[model samples]
Target: MPNWLLPENIADVLPSEARKIEDLRRLILDNFRLHGYELVMPPMLEYLESLLAGAGQDTEGMTFKLVDQLSGRTLGVRADMTTQVARIDAHLLNRASLTRLCYAGSVLRTLPQGLHATREPFQIGAEIYGHAGLEADAEIQHLALTSLALAGITQVRLDLCHVGILRAIIAEDATAQKDEMALVKLLEAKDTPGLQVMSADYAPITREALLALPNLYGDITVLDRARQVLPALPAIASALDQLQALAEAAGPECVTIDLADLRGYHYESGAIFGAYVPGLPNALVRGGRYDHVGEAFGRSRPATGFSMDLRELARLMPGAQRKLAIRAPWSTEAGLKEKLQECIVALRKAGEIVIQNLPGHENDQDEFNCDRAVVLENGHWVIKNLD
Candidate 1:
C-alpha cells in the first residue's frame, strides 16, 4: 500500500476546496454571531460517558471510542457536537437566562454516513438553550435556512417532523412502547408491511396509527391529513399544531412534512427538521428540539439546534478562484534591499498578498495568481502590472 494513501472515505482537502470551506465557515460563523449566538469550542475528544451523555444509540454507534493512557478512562472522539454544546450549557456556563451557543469543528465518526461521505466531517451548528416553547424551535429553524441562504444555496426544501407524534402514539400502549426502536426503524424506512407485522400485537389504535404514519408525508396539507388519520390525543394534536406553525413560519413554498422521517427520533424531543438543497439527495442540515439532553448533565434545559458538514456544503459550491497577488523579486542589493522590504510590508499591511519570488524560483507557479509585480524602477520601489 502506498504510504500517502488516505483511509477509505477520508481524504485531504487541497488549496481550492480548503479555501471554499474556510470562506463558508467564516460566513456562517459571522452570521451566527450577528444572531447573538456566542461561539464555543469543545475538545475533539472527551470521556466516553460525558460525550455520549444525552446522545442516543445512533450517535453511540457512530462515535469512535478508545481508552486514555493517562486517565485510564474510556474516551470517545465526538461524532457530533450538539451533545457537547448541550453539556456546556448545562454545566460550564450555567447561565440562568436564555443562552445561545454556536460551534464549528471537525468530528471523527467510526464510519462514513454515506458511500462517499468523509469520516472526518467539519461540523458547524448553533443551539438555543433555556426556552422550551415552539418559538425556540422556530428560531433555530430560521437560522439554519438563513445560514444555507448565506452559502448561496437559495433553493432549499425544509422537511419538518415531530418526535412527539410517535411518542404520543405509543405513550399508553405497552406493546408499541416496548418495540419503539424497531418501530422507528420501520417508520424511517417507510416499510408498511414491516410495520404491519411489527405492530400486530399492539393496541388497535396504536397499530392503526403506526400503519398510518408511513403515508403521512408531503406538503403542509399532510398536517391536515395527519390530524384526521392519527388519534386525537393531546400530545399528537400538539405535535401537529407545532409542525403547522413552523411550516407556516418557514413559508409554504419551501416546506414539507414527513411524520415517518424520524431521523433524530431517539434524541430529539420535538419539531425535528432537515434542510435539503438541490444537488444533495440527503439533508444538508439537520436540527430539532432536544429538551431532555441537558438533563444528562444534571441540569435540564430546553434546547434546539441544527448542524451541517461544512466539508460537504463546500463541495456543493463552485471552486474558489485563485486570489490575486503581487509578485516581488528577492533583492539583497545594498540600497534596494531596505526599500524593497519596506514596500512589501506596506503592501501586505494594506491587504495585498505579496509573494516574494526567490532567484531560482522565478518561473514557479503556485496557488496565488500574481497579476501584479513590485519593481525597483528608477531607484524607487513601485507596483506594476505583470505582463
Candidate 2:
C-alpha cells in the first residue's frame, strides 16, 4: 500500500482498548447524569460555519475542513465538543432559560506536521447555558469532583482559577500582556524562574499573584493566602468565594482551590479549571465559562461547560491485564451458534472473558488464546483446560 493512503495522526480503536474506553466513558456519563446533566449526542459532522461560529482562531486551526458534495458547501469535523454544544444551544435548544447538557463522542483535529498529537480524541463533557452567577461556577466545580470520584480517581487535585481576573487585568493594562503569556508558559512547564522574568513588569501585588501561581497549587488554604495578597478585585474576589464554597461542598479531603490557575481557552469568561491525577503530566479534564461565545452565533447567552480528554484518563487508568478467556466448541452443529452464544452470555454474566470457536479451530486456538475451554462431548457439556 502507498504511504500517502494512510490517514495522518488518526488511529483505529481495537476491541480491547475500545472496550476499556467505553467503560470509562460510561462511568463519567453516569456520574454526570447523577449531577443532572442530560446527555446530548451532537452530530459528528457539522457545517463549517456553524461549528466555527463560537470557536476562536486557535480552535479553528485544528478543524478538518472539507466541502459537502451534496450541498456544495463547506463542512468540517468537530475539533471540540463544547463549540458544537454551544451551537446546539443557540439554534436547536432555543430555551428561554438555562439548559444543562452532557455528551460523549469522538472529536477530530489536525496535528502539527511533525509534532506528536492525537488527531482523534474521545471527549465526555457537560454544558450549562443561560445562568449568570458564581453559584453556577461552583456547581460545575463540584460536578467535576464527582466525576473524578466515579472514575475511581481519588488522588485528584483540582486547580481552580478565574479567567475574568486575568482578562480584566489584561484588558485594562497592556503592559502585562507579554508577561501573562509567559506566565502561562511557565505554569505549563512548571518553571518558576521563567514566570519571575515574565511577570517583572507588573505591580508588586500583581507580580506576586502571578509568581505565586506556580507554587499556589494546593488545598483551601491557598485561597486564604490569595485573599491576603491580592487586592479586592470583584471578579477575582467572587471567583475566590465560589472556589471556597466548592471546596466546602466537596469536603476538605477531596477538593483544593488554586487562585493562580489562570490558563484556559480564549473563549473563557469566568472561572477556569482542570483536574489532575497522580502520574499524569496533562489534565484529565478542562472546563470554564465562555458567555461571550454565544454572542457570535447571535444567541447572546452565557454558557459554561467542561470536557475530559478520555485519552489522558485512559492513560492513567491502572493497567488492566486482559480477563481470563473462555473458549466454546461448536462441533456438533446442533444449534451451535445459539449454544455458543449462550455460553458466551453466561461467562459475561459471571464476569469472565469469553470467546466462541468452531471445531478444528479449537486446536488452532487464536481466539483469545483462551485460558480455558468448554467442549460439547457426546450429548453433554465437557470442560477442557487450555493451560
Candidate 3:
C-alpha cells in the first residue's frame, strides 16, 4: 500500500469541494447566530467516560477510544457534537432560561452510518436547551427545515415520528419487554413475519398494533390509521397528536408519520424526524426532541435539534461558492513592485480572491480561474482580463 493510503471510508477534501463546504458552513453558522444560538467548539478529544456518559451504548460503539499518555485515562474522539454541546449547556453554562447553541466540526466515526457515508463527517448542528414545550419542538423542526433550505435544499419531504409511543407501549407490554431487541430489529427492517412471531404472545390488540407500525408511514392518513386501529393508549394518542401538530405547522408538501421511528432510541425521548430530497438516498437533515440526554452531566434538560453531513451536502451541490479570482504578477519593477503589493491587500480586504502568480509555479492557476490579472500598462498597475 502507498503511504498516502487513507483508512477505509475516509478521504481528503480536494480544493473544489473544500470551497463549497466552507461556504455552506459559514451560511449555516450565520443562520444559527441570527437565531441567537451561541457557537462553541469542543475539543477533538475528551475523557471517554465523560464523552460517553450521556450518549449511551450506541454512541459508545461509534466513538474511537484510545489511552491517554498524560494520565493513563481512556479518551474517545467525538462521534457526534450533540453530546458535547449538551454537556456544555448543562454542566458548564448552567443557564436557567432557554439556551440555543450551535456547532460545526469534524467527527470521527468508527463505522459509516449508512451507504456512501464517510468515517469522518463534517457535522454541523444546533440545539435548544431548557425547554420542553411542543412549541420548542416546533421551533426545532422549523430550524431544521430552514437549515436544509439554506443548503440549497429547499424542497424536502419530512418524516415525523415519536419514540415515546413505542417506549410507553414496551413498558406496558410483557412480551415486548421480554424481547425488545428482536422487536426493534424487526421494526427497523419492516419484517412482518418476524414481528408477528415476536409479538405472538401479546394481546390481540397489542399484537395487531405492534405489527401495524411498519405500515404506519405515509401522509396524515397514517396517523388516522394509527388512531383508528392501534390500541388507544394515552401515550400513543398523545404522540400521534404531536405528530399531527408538527406536520401541519411544518407545512412540508410531503409529510409522513412513523410511530416506530427510533433512530436514537437510547437518547431521544420524544418526537424524531428526518428530511429528505429527491436524489439523496438518505435524509439530508435529521432532528427531534431529546429531553433527558444531559442527565449524566447532573442536570437534566429538555433538548431538541438537528444535524447533517456538510461533506455530503457539498457533494450534492458541486458548484464552487467562491468569488472571482484575480491573478497578480510577482513583479520587481521600481514603480510597480510596491504598488502591486498594496493593490493585492486592498482587493483581499474587499472580499476578493487575488492569487499571486509566484515564480515557476504555473500549475497554481490550475486550481483557480485566472480570468483577470494585474499588469503594468503605461507605467501604472491596472486590472485587465487575460487575452
lDDT of 2 at 288: 80
| Regions of model 1 farther than 4 Å from truth | 363-366
Tell me how far the alpha carbon of residue 282 in candidate 2 is from the true structure, in angstroms, after superposition. Answer: 1.4
359: Cα error in model 3, Å: 2.5
The lDDT for every candidate, in the order shown, is 0.91, 0.72, 0.85
Give the local distance difference test score of model 2: 0.72
Tens digits of per-residue lDDT for model 2, 71-133: 989998988888777777887888997888999988887873223446788888888888987
Clashes of 2: 0
Model 1, 184-303: lDDT tens digits are 999999999999888888899999999999999899999999999999999999999999999999999899999999988888888999999988888999999988888889999788
Q: What TM-score would each prediction reach against the true structure? A: 0.98, 0.79, 0.95
Q: Write the per-residue lDDT of candidate 3 for residues 208-294, one digit (tens) a residue.
A: 878888988888888888888877788889988999899999973578777666677767888899888877888878898888888
Winner on TM-score between 1 and 3 is 1
Model 2 C-alpha RMSD to native: 4.4
Using lDDT as the measure, the top candidate is 1
Question: For model 3, where is the 10-residue window of minimal lDDT?
Answer: 361-370
